[model samples]
Target: MPATGFDNTIEVVAVVVVVVVVVVVVVVVVVVVAVGVDVHVVVALVVVIVAAVVVVIVVVVVVVVVVVVVPLVVVVEALVVSNGLWYYPHL
Candidate 1:
């Protein structure tokens, strides 16, 4: 077996992130169930799930912005530059 370099690395990364998030969500659900249903615990689990989802969304958004926006900004800058048409926006 051999690995190939990803051309659309951001898409690949997003896919991986989605898979991981699904797995983690499932695991968290199972843990919540196994621990016995309690209102507080269920609430906590919901919060955890929501938080995980938010984090994943944020990660995907940031990656996408970097992948798509950065290049567009660069090209636009090359074509025509504003005061700050293209600059690395640090996280």
Candidate 2:
């Protein structure tokens, strides 16, 4: 894959994360203001949402590392080896 494609994928992932966080925040605020939910309930809801967001972020990071960074690294390593750029000295 091209570098531009990787850049686009990263941008898309970032946008998705931002959108998810913003939507969660909006929903929580709307529920508090319009529904007048109990304070404890709101707090619990926020906790759950936060945990979910954290999980999402972790998953995305792992995916990007595995899918994008790892492949890129392997490609670069292969290129270096093929070009005889890597150096070794007898010890």
TM-score of 2: 0.56
Compute the lDDT for candidate 1: 0.72
TM per prediction = 0.57, 0.56
lDDT of 2 by residue, 34-82 (tens): 7687886678677869876796878688777867798899899878877
State candidate 1's TM-score: 0.57
**Tens-digit per-residue lDDT, 1-91, candidate 1:** 3332335677777787878688777877777777777886677777777887787887778777877887787678766545564565561
Model 2 lowest lDDT segment of ten: 1-10
Total colliding residue pairs, candidate 2? 0
Candidate 2: deviation at residue 68, Å? 0.2
